[model samples]
Target: MGKNRLQLENHLFILPDYLNHPFISGNKLRKLKYNVLEAKKQKKETLLTFGGAYSNHIAAVAYAGKEYGFKTVGVIRGEELADSISQNPTLTFAQNCGMEFKFVSREQYRNKNNPLFLNQLKEAFHNIYVLPEGGTNALAVKGCEEILEEADAKFDYICCPVGTGGTISGLINSSFKHQKIIGFPALKGDFLNKEITKFAAKTNWELNLDYHFGGYAKVTDALIAFINTFKLQYNIPLDPIYTGKMMFGICDMIQKGYFDENAKILAVHTGGLQGIAGMNTVLKQQNKPLIV
Candidate 1:
């Protein structure tokens, strides 16, 4: 996925997959590449997906649909956000890309995977290609498999932020048996273990649960400070939701002597920078420092 590696520290390198595309960046691009092709093969006219107000997946899917000549539909969670779309950067961007929105309640969104609910959506939108929330599916994993090049095998460990487990699963499948794949989950729970095993063909990966920092989208002042400091120091923008926490944990582990001496580490910078504006909005309402 990357050849221009940025050295963050001694034996630590970052694969800036974010530079792949302006809108559909990083893992979002990897996860959608094959799915978009599949949708075209199916002769679909509309691409439908689900996400929250500030979802990176929603923003990416909208832009992808616009770029690929398909109508985009976002089944957004939280109906209350419907009227406030203008205030949300991600949603606004998606809307500007010609994405139609169907704001559903949290309870209704929970039924997103149910057969009846899916059937209802299928009935409502003809010739629609449905992408699951977080965009994790078999095809997504296949696309993610291309993230790590043969040259990446030189590293002892590969690290990435885990959302729906698709990216790490692909890395697990493609990585050398001698290389360890470490996933820093953005969400809390042991549920991802089972979810990841569904698509991953190998057992070379493990999740680090300690870095989620109070769970998905929940961040402390320290995390905000770290993100700002990291960008200031390295000129790499990280979203508060995923990559920021992963980097925080990685730095903490390095300081704690978690890695073997002289071991090389490669971290995948899965982009979600689109969410920064929305997150900073929340931070401001709470009177907290922003991720500059």
Candidate 2:
């Protein structure tokens, strides 16, 4: 992506979060930095994680685990995905990275954190380093806090897409009082406030809940069009699950006079471009325009 690609206005700067390694890019790398170390310290050889089908977290964790010499097991949410794993790009990538799958029904997945469910897993797989869904834990939050550097202090607004709240909570903690952290949630709900508040220690942040388009993993023609145009103009790839929605929300807010005219906003591109191929697969199945 060119430096001037995201020049929607003089006030906004887009940080291309996917320019790093093909795997472990953006906030995923930030969230995993500490967890991997702790797993090492604990002498864990197996990493067991949870995610829905086509989860970016799943792909990242699988790759990270492979690179770090750990046996990776993903407890996937949909049992139906078990037979179709070969067709799903995200799951296929994780599988190719040496991640084994334990697909359970949606009902069983609802109890993913239940003690009984965990005890059952303990019996099934010993020495497992468990990571929760979306990899949002205290260690993950601590890792996320390092995303902003000293040079980022000049920006008036720090923007990022909200997934499991760990990333935005980190942004909120690291941001200065004068620099408000703005999160555009990819899911439609006020429920994330409680999750974010669990780790956020500052008040210089708020959520724009109107930009989910539909809901988690949902997309509209307008959103698809916007994403396509954005890539064409910016030469940046954004996944539909997170960063795409945030960028749309930021642009819509700016257009609606939601921010101060002089406010300088830096949008953190929390990388999920890996999920785009899977997302486009879904779009094609639905007869929708593919994300260009």
Using TM-score as the measure, the top candidate is: 1
Residues 27-130 of candidate 2 have per-residue lDDT tens digits of: 98988889999999999989899999989899999999989999999999988898998899999999999999999999999998898999888789889899
Q: Each prediction's Cα lDDT score?
A: 0.94, 0.88
Report how far off residue 254 is in candidate 1 (Å). 0.5
Question: Which one wins on lDDT?
Answer: 1
TM-score list, all predictions: 0.98, 0.96
What's model 2's TM-score?
0.96
All candidates: CA RMSD (Å): 1.0, 2.0
- The pairs that clash in candidate 1 are none
What would the per-residue lDDT of candidate 1 be over residues 68-112, giving only the tens digit for each residue? 999999999999999998999999999999999999999999999
Clash statistics: count for each candidate: 0, 0
